[model samples]
Every structure is written in structure tokens, then in C-alpha cells.
Target: MENDREGPVPQNGSEGPVPRVGVAVFLLRGKTVLLGKRRSSLGDSTFALPGGHLEFGESFEDCAAREVKEETGLEIDKMEFLTVTNNPFLDEPKPSHYVVIFIRALLRDPQQVPQNLEPNKCDGWDWYDWNNLPNPLFWPLENMVQSGFNPFPID
Candidate 1:
């Protein structure tokens, strides 16, 4: 396996063949959820949940909490496993793959406003009503919607 400063080099000499494991958090407040516009190469300008690659030895719940805090600067209180997705961006201009673990969580402080801690990776954060999400969602999110995976469920 070839390795680079970034990480392992894919056999195809593009990205990596190993599916990068990541965690996405759906931070909920009432009927709205928090979303950020990605600024990175993988899904630039697309609306995505706050998340990143899972660190080695980190539990999914811990990764979700950590990523939410790191990316949005908001602490999460409770988190539950929502779903998992195997996203293969073979048709994308820049092909890649990911094994994404989705987790549903609530903000530790309901009144706290999210800040963009990493502007290089994300433009900013905004709350959108679950019923009316923004267009051009990230591929995994688009798939999630098409598959009838509603993040918000009536309890």
C-alpha cells in the first residue's frame, strides 16, 4: 500500500481505495436541523451535516460529539445511532468513497448559536426545517432522502 503525507494512496492513483470512515451528526432543535455548506474538495458548496472522519479508537457516539463540537463549536447532549451509508462517488468529477455513520443528537444548549470553527472546510452553519431542506445536498444526504430515510420522526 502506498502512503502519502495525507494518507494512503488509492491503487488507482486517485483517492484511496479504503473507504474512509466518518460520522455525521444531525443536530436537532424542534423540527429544524443544523446543516453546513461544505468548503472542502470532497463536496464543495453542498449542504451537509456537521461531521468528519472518525478518529482511530473513537466510538461512533464520541466521534459524532467530537465532530459536531469541532466543526460547529456547539456541544451535543444526547446522541443515538440513526443509520449508516456506503457512498461511492464513482460518477463524481473527483471520485471517492466513504462509510458514513449518521447519528441524531441534540444541542447541549438550545439557545446556543453555532459558529464556524473551520472556515476552510465549511462556509457556515444554518438551521433548516426538516420538511424543506435546501437544494444540492451532498450525495450521501441526497441518497438518504431518496431512500425515505427521514431524520425527523414523530415521537
Candidate 2:
């Protein structure tokens, strides 16, 4: 992947290879939500939602479950669509991904939610009231939470 001052470029079939993709699931509980701190070297050690890339042949919902389980070890009772933000930061050869797919997920047991992975995916895990979540939630979660937009349809 060449790094020019501009950004990334898609490779021609005769030139190189296809790009890799990733996804994110923003699981919400009541007025509170879940966020994961990046212990890995990928992001800026910033705090974000619980999610990861899509596996080959896996449905988006399945991938969402997998990521949540891998990171938080909790099973999501339900999930609803939220929003998609196209990350406009990339350079040639190395394709930058769409970043994340936000989803509002309902957890069966918010009080009993546990982190199964050791040392754990993040250094810490805590639930925050959507009205007053910490300011450092890297994405536009605060705005979304405030809007009261319910993606899940009620019968």
C-alpha cells in the first residue's frame, strides 16, 4: 500500500488486489450503551462500540453476535439497524474501510453482563447512561442516543 499525501486508491485488476472489509455493531441497553476501548494497535486506543469485521459467508447479524460475544461475552437478545458512517480517511493500495455499522441491541441481562475474554478485549467495561455518557465516546453515539430514534419497530 503506497502512502501519498492525498489518500488511498483502489488497485486495478491488472495492478494489485481487492480490499478488505470490516463492520461494527453498536449494541444499546435501555438508555445506556456498550463501548470497547481499543487495546489493540488498530485505532488510537480510543473508546468505541463493541464490534469487529465481517467473516466470509457470515450474515451481518451473525457477525454482530460474534463480535459482541468475542468482546463482551454477552448474547444479544435483539438488534436493530442504526446508521452507517463512511470513513473518508484512506490512502492508495491499502483501502480504508467504511469503519462501523451502528446497531441498537437489546441485552437480556444488563446487570449480569460480563466480559468473558481475559485481560479482556478492553482494559475496562462500564455501562453509562446515554444522557450522560463520557464525552470521549469517539463516534457520534451521544448524538444518536439523544435523538431517541428507535430503529426497532414495535408491534
Candidate 3:
């Protein structure tokens, strides 16, 4: 028997292997969505939604707002929880499990623009037509697509 070091073992002294909670924000601008090119070690160079890990005792909306501001320098409102995806990245060298909370949100102001606040973590942000997304999407995003999750409202 061997223990897989998917990620740093928990320091809490529990059984270990705790799943991390990630909040994926979908900033919808009409028929388009906002995406950023990840520069982080996990999803390097892949296009992903604007979101990050859910902090201790923080509500989903709070996490969404914070991550959006931190990642894209944009404020968001009217957050509606779209769906949840369980992503297990066990095949990668640094494997881990993530319970991703997909949140569909809108810009607080229509004219507010996004900036590369964390240039080291991500490239600049861009508006993308949901139907015409760029290739090599991040794992959770790909999971959403594969599950046929649509951010748009049904007409």
C-alpha cells in the first residue's frame, strides 16, 4: 500500500485528503462571457473563468465578488448559482480533488472594464461568445461544457 501525495497533506491532523472548494465566476456580458488566460501552475495557459478558492466561513457571493475583483479588477452582482462540478485531477503530477461552485454573475456596471490585476496568475481578460470559446479550457470549465451547462437564460 502506498499513499498518493496528490497535494500537501492536511495540517489539521485529520485523516487527510481534504477536497478544496473553488468558486468559478461566470461574468456574463450579454451573449458573451469573460475569460482569462491562466498563468497559475495548475491550469497554466488554459482559458478559465474568474474565480478562486473559497475561504473559511466566507459565503459564496462574497468569494465570487472578491475573486472577480482580484482576478479581473471588475465588480460583479446578481450572482446566481448555476451548477456544481466535481473535478478530480488525479492523473496530473500534482493531483487533487476540487469541488467547484459555478456562479453566473453580471458586471455591477456595464461600462466597467477588466484589468490584469494579478499579472503573475493570469493574463488579461477578454469577452468571448459562449458558443465560440477558445480552445484548451481549464478542467472545471471543460467539465461544465461536457455536462452541457449553458450560462444563458432560456428563451
lDDT of each: 0.78, 0.56, 0.80
When sorted by lDDT, best at the front, the candidate numbers are 3, 1, 2
lDDT winner between 1 and 2, please give it: 1
Clashes of each: 0, 5, 0
Q: Give me the candidate number with maximum TM-score.
A: 3
Per-residue lDDT of candidate 2, residues 1-155 (tens digit)? 01011223355544533343445665666556666555543343456676666667977678777777776788886776667655533442434544456666777676656573633346555676655666555433434546674444455
How big is the positional error of residue 38 in model 1, measured in Å on the Cα after superposition? 1.0
TM-score of 1: 0.87
Q: Which residue pairs overlap in candidate 3's backbone?
A: none
* lDDT, candidate 1, at 50: 87
lDDT of 1 by residue, 1-155 (tens): 00001222375576546567778888899999899888766667889898877777999999888888887889998788998888766775556677788899998889899998888787789999988999889878877888888887569
Query: Using lDDT as the measure, which candidate wins?
Result: 3
Off by over 4 Å in 1: 1-16
Alpha-carbon runs more than 4 Å astray in model 3: 1-6, 9-11
Candidate 2 — worst ten consecutive residues by lDDT sum? Answer: 1-10
lDDT of 2 at 100: 50
- Which wins on TM-score, candidate 1 or candidate 2? 1
